[model samples]
Target chain A: MNFFACENLSAGYGRKEVLKNITLSFEKGRIASVIGPNGSGKSTLLKCMGRLLKPSAGCVYLDGRSISSMTDSAIARSVGILPQSPSAPGDIPVHCLVAYGRNPHKKALSSFTKEDRETVEWAMHATGLQDKRFLRLGQLSGGERQRAWIAMALAQRPQILLLDEPTTYLDIHHQFEVLELLEKLNTSCGLTVVMVMHDLNLASKFSGRLIAMKDGQVLLDGCAEEVLTEENIFDIFRVKSRIVDMDGSRAAMYMGVA
Target chain B: MREITDSDAKRRLMTGAAGLMLLAAGFVVSVITGTVDISVGDMARIFTGVQTDGMYHVLMNIRLPRIITGAFVGVNLALSGAILQAVLKNPLADPGIVGVTAGAGLFAMAVMILLPSFTHLVPPAAFIGAFVTSLVIYFLAYDGGAHPLRLILAGVALAAFLGAFMSSLTVLYSDRVQGTVNWMAGSLSGKSWIHVKMILPYTLLGLFGAGIGARYLNILMLGDDVARGLGLSVERVKFMLTMLAALLAASAVSVAGLLGFVGLIVPHITRLIIGSDNRFLIPFSAVFGGIIVIFADTAARVVFAPYELPVGVVMAFVGAPFFLYLLSRSSRS
Candidate 1:
């Protein structure tokens, strides 16, 4: 069975539907990237998948169970989400904020256990945030702050990690750094990694599978090399581009779209 | 940085220790000096199962009630202020500033004037008024969500309106105006064990609720979108917070009659020391609020000798500049 599946899903804000009739399934332990334009509902779809937003029509299933019927804490234990903008109150330290991710795992009046502390430490280590653990989120650079939020999500010890524009404000080096960390997390920990990315190059480079979306519908879904063809790019993104094999690999690079 | 950390720990220890010592001192001073001043030796003797004529009567009846009332009002105002600040997501949001106190006071006075026999009706009536006003402010501020600017604007307008209503009510009942005026000024004079007993239950209940609710308040300070993203039912939490805040204010209004800035200033100071962890902030504010009120009450009585200034007036004198300073600092930040 697919780890996460959306069947005939429809979702949106109050009245307007942002995503319509979307059907997709994520395999266990695979890095999947959804790429689209500004208002293509990529972020919205991710939110619905994470059970942050209620699906207006149809249902989302996680590991054969319907997501809609699941309790928040139950879903939280299985799935961790890093929002586009994860905020902290005042100058809250990274360690303290990361400890909050363990909230779902905590029973009422339960203090942090040795295992919980170890997980937090491991998360911090994985995200290269060991040195900056005591620093406040507000004090860190944008990239470091993003990593802190990721570390927090990691501390949930989730089977699936969903990210919304995980590399929005990072420099190229930091962007690669974050994506590489996600890659390691996918390979080493066998996490079901899914994210929405705007940069097609980064999406192609990092994600094993790519799903292209347009106007609230999935236009193409396949392996990164197959779906990211010049003709498919033109059809979905409404642009012209030349697809070239980069470094003798099947992964296609778009020179430009005009 | 190391030196600063040490100093910070030392400063906190010293400050908390000083506060504790001063609290003890304040209690002793409150016991020793009152309407009829009792000597320390005689006071000691009275405590040690030796009953003296004037000292025993004075300590048991007058001084004890006054100090207890002062302490009760102090803690009530502080906890209410802290909760209000957290709820409104503004350091400046207090019972007095938002007109909850005026609304509560107005309802209580209306009862006092129209139905003098319903002495037990005051706290509940005040609580209802405060709760209703907070709900009104919350609804007025609710657009897609309760925006801070809108909430504050509504609070300001409502406070002004309620203040006008309370003043008008006082003028309307000019025959019993002194009693109304004294109550409005936040005096702890002439209070008995009954008044002490009356506020204790509500204060205890309100503080207990604030204690549990403080964790959510810490989450709320992170902003609504993030809070919602974390699976905290945002609107429900806000409603719960506002109600908790109202309870704090209403219970306080019953005791101190619209004591301002205890909710505003004390919590801000506590936040500066302990950070915004509600677990520490709420209790610390309660302690500081109690101390400030006791200290203020002491000054209120002794400052003008026999002619006692209202503790509320004394608090305003101390709290107003601090309020302005904080206002400017927050705007700048």
Candidate 2:
């Protein structure tokens, strides 16, 4: 059975169709990233996969069950989505933020059980935020806060994690830090990650598979080598680009508008 | 964020204790410092059920019920404001400021005057009025989201509109406007056990509803998209909370008229003292809200000796400035 898949999904906001008849499937224990220019419907596609937005046409199937068939919390138990710049009240501490990730697993008014506490601690530890657990979100640096949010998503103990532009606001070092953490989680915990990424080089380096989209349709989908060709880059982004191989890893270096 | 930390839990417990203590102290102050003073010894006798004829009438019948009514009014309005703030993501949202109380007041006035025989239905009528007013204000302010300025502006306009109708009613029925003058002033004067009975059930409901809804309010602070991503039915939760707030404000308005500032500033102060974890924040606001109103009513009773001021007047004097300060501070942020 497909782990998570959106089959011929078409969704939009109030007559503005952003995603049109898009079909994609993600396998278990793999990292795939979607990359495209602004308004290319990358974020919309990610939202559909997470069932944040309902499709006007077709449906999303999570492990052979239609998404519309399950309750919201049920979907959340198997899949966790972190939208762009997820925030909590700043006064809440690090550990507390991570605990919110378990929102799907627990009842609304249920007291925190030992299992919940253990999972929260594990999520904080996995994100390397055990030291900062007591510190409030406002006290943490940008990178640390991002990890805290990531830890919260991990607290759900979801099999599939979806993120929209997870590294948008961070600097390069922080970007790599976040991506490396995701790579570690994917390999170590067998977590499936599907994200919308803006950085081409980072996407190619960390993700095993990359899907490039243009005008709400996938232009290319394959490994870094197969998809990051100079011709494909020029056609997709409409820019002159030269592929540079450094240490057996390819980087698409854009010169200017094509 | 998640579960409790020891220090956090301890701090919350201590704050809760402090709040309850203040509320008890407020009751004593409200009971004793009235126009006719009841001494500690008299209070002891009154509580012990040895009814001393001289102080018993003033203390048991008049003073005690008014205090109870004022206390419940404080809690209901404060919780109303707290829920609205979190649900709408607008710090300035309050029953009085948002025209909810005016709606309640208007409906209440209509029931009391036009349908005098149906006076028993004032609370429920006010509830429907409050609910509809909030819904109207929400749509007016809700251009994509409930922006703070937009909400306050809509509320101010609606309140002014409702205020005009109230004045016209006062003009048309000049003979029977005495009872409503107190409602317009928004005080707990001349209240009895009947007033207490009016708002008591709502206070219990508010407490229970608040307990269940606090967790969702915290989740909603993460913004709607994030909240929904976690499998929360965001719209449903918000609607429930807004209705609860409207009911609370309606209960208070039906009993004590249009008390302002208790809703706006009480929760704001409580949040400042403790953090915005609504589990603690709601109860804390309730207690502190009680304390503020009780003391304000006490001040109203004693400020000019025999000539008493309405608690709403006192609240506006203090609350308006505090509101302006908050606006300035928030804008800077």
Candidate 3:
């Protein structure tokens, strides 16, 4: 069964209509990436799927249940989402931030259970942030901070994870580190992963499926070999590009404007 | 990671315990150091049902009620400020700075002036005024949403307007000027058990509500989009927390007039010791805020001996400088 899907989803901020008539689905245990040019409604589509923005026109489903009908805690348990450019109070320690992800699972006024602590520790260990758990967020490098946020989402123990531009502000090395981390989680834990990506080459290399968006609509949905072709890149991004074979993976190398 | 979290938890526990101790000390100091100068032994005797008539009368009727009222008022204001700061994601958010107190004061003055016969209605009226003013500030700050800087600016403007209106009402009512001025100065002077009774239920209810809402507040600090993405009902939680904050502030204002600085400073100080986790911060702020107010009120009564200054004046003297220091330090950092 598909782990997540959205049908006829249209959303916007105050009638601006950033996403229109979008229908998409992601199967369980697959890593999918949404790639698009600036202002092509990529982030908006992710927000709609994550239930951060209510659709003006349709519904989102998680594990065969309509998201709108699910209780907030129910949806939280099934799907964890990390928004682009997430922030926390500056002085909060990494461990505390990650522990907050257990919020959906715990009752009010209840102390953390043994299971909750294990989950938090597992998240920190997965993200390689055990050493920095006591450090304040403001004291971390940019990549570490991003990992802290991902660790926070992982602590939720969701079957599906949605991320928006998770690598936007990082250096190239850090960017790949994050993508590789997600890849590991996807392959090992069978965590169905969906992320919005700006780097076409990185997206092509890491994602099992790629969905290209243009003007608030899906332009292409296929594997890298189908979606990362030169003609498709020009048509969607209005830029000329070359497809290069590197290390048994396809990479899109942009040349010049179309 | 486990060790670090364990230590952090230990630190929080220590801070909370210390705060409670300080609050108890402040309570004893307030009871013992009044004009009559009752000793600890005298206090013990009075409590043990020894008929030390004058000391017992003073402790039970006047000093105990006044100190308890101050403590409750402090707790209410501090918790209100902490909630506002977290929900609005603004460090400068306090009832006094954001005009919540002024709004309450406005309606409270109106009640005293126009509906003098219905004095019992003042708290509710003040609550309405505070709720309305907060809504006005909230909407005005909201372009797409309430930015921290925009919210502060709107609060300042609204506070100025309400402060002016309140001043005008005081002037127009010449006959009631003395009482109004004392109340406006945020005095806990002349409070009896009746005033304590009036505020206790609201204070308890507000604190309980804030304690329950701390988890939501933790999510809220992560920004709105992130909060919603985490499966929180962002708008609903924000509305509920804002109303809770306004209720707490209005209750404090009604009982204690316009106590400033306690709300603004106590939360920051508590955050310094306990960090920003509302679960710990809320209760710590309540206790520390109570301690500060009791001490400040005690100073207000004893510092000048023959003449007493309004406790609000004492707070302003300390609070204004501390606020400026924090502002400069933050800017530098």
Position B221, candidate 2: lDDT: 85
Instruction: Quantify all predictions' global Cα lDDT against the true fold.
Output: 0.79, 0.86, 0.86
Cα error, residue A32 of model 2, in Å, equals: 0.8
lDDT of 1 at B22: 74
How far off is model 1, as Cα RMSD?
3.3
Lowest-sum lDDT 10-residue window in model 2 chain B: B1-10
Where is model 1 more than 4 Å wrong at Cα?
A226-244, A248-258, B1-15, B33-35, B96-99, B116-120, B135-178, B223-238
Candidate 2, residue B299: how far the Cα is off, in Å: 1.0
> How far is A168's C-alpha from truth in model 3 (Å)?
1.5
lDDT by residue for model 1 over B1-333, one digit each (tens)? 245335545766776787778788888887876567777887788888687686787787777777887787778778877887876777777776455776787787887776778856866777677767877877877876777778788878888888787778778887766656666777787777877887787679777878777767776776664454444566777777676666667777776676777788888888888677676788778888878888888888888888998888999999899988888997898
* Residues forming the 10-long window of minimal summed lDDT in candidate 1 chain A: A248-257
Q: Candidate 2, clashing residue pairs? A: A96-B1, A96-B2, A97-B1
Of the candidates numbered 1 and 3, which has the greater TM-score value?
3
Candidate 2 lDDT over residue span A1-258, tens digit each: 357898998888878998878888889999999999899999989888888787889889899889899998898888889999877788998877888888888786688999999999999999999988988999988889999988988998899999999898999988988999999999999999999998889999989899999888888999999989989988888888999989878898889993
From the highest lDDT down, the ranking of the candidates is: 3, 2, 1
Which residue segments of model 3 deviate by more than 4 Å? B1-7, B97-99, B115-124, B135-157, B174-176
Error of 2 at B76 (Å): 0.6
Q: For model 2, how does the per-residue alpha-carbon lDDT over B139-202 read when each residue is reduced to its tens digit?
A: 8887645555677789889989988998899899988887666666688888899989889999
lDDT measured at residue B320 in model 2 versus the true structure, 0 to 100? 91
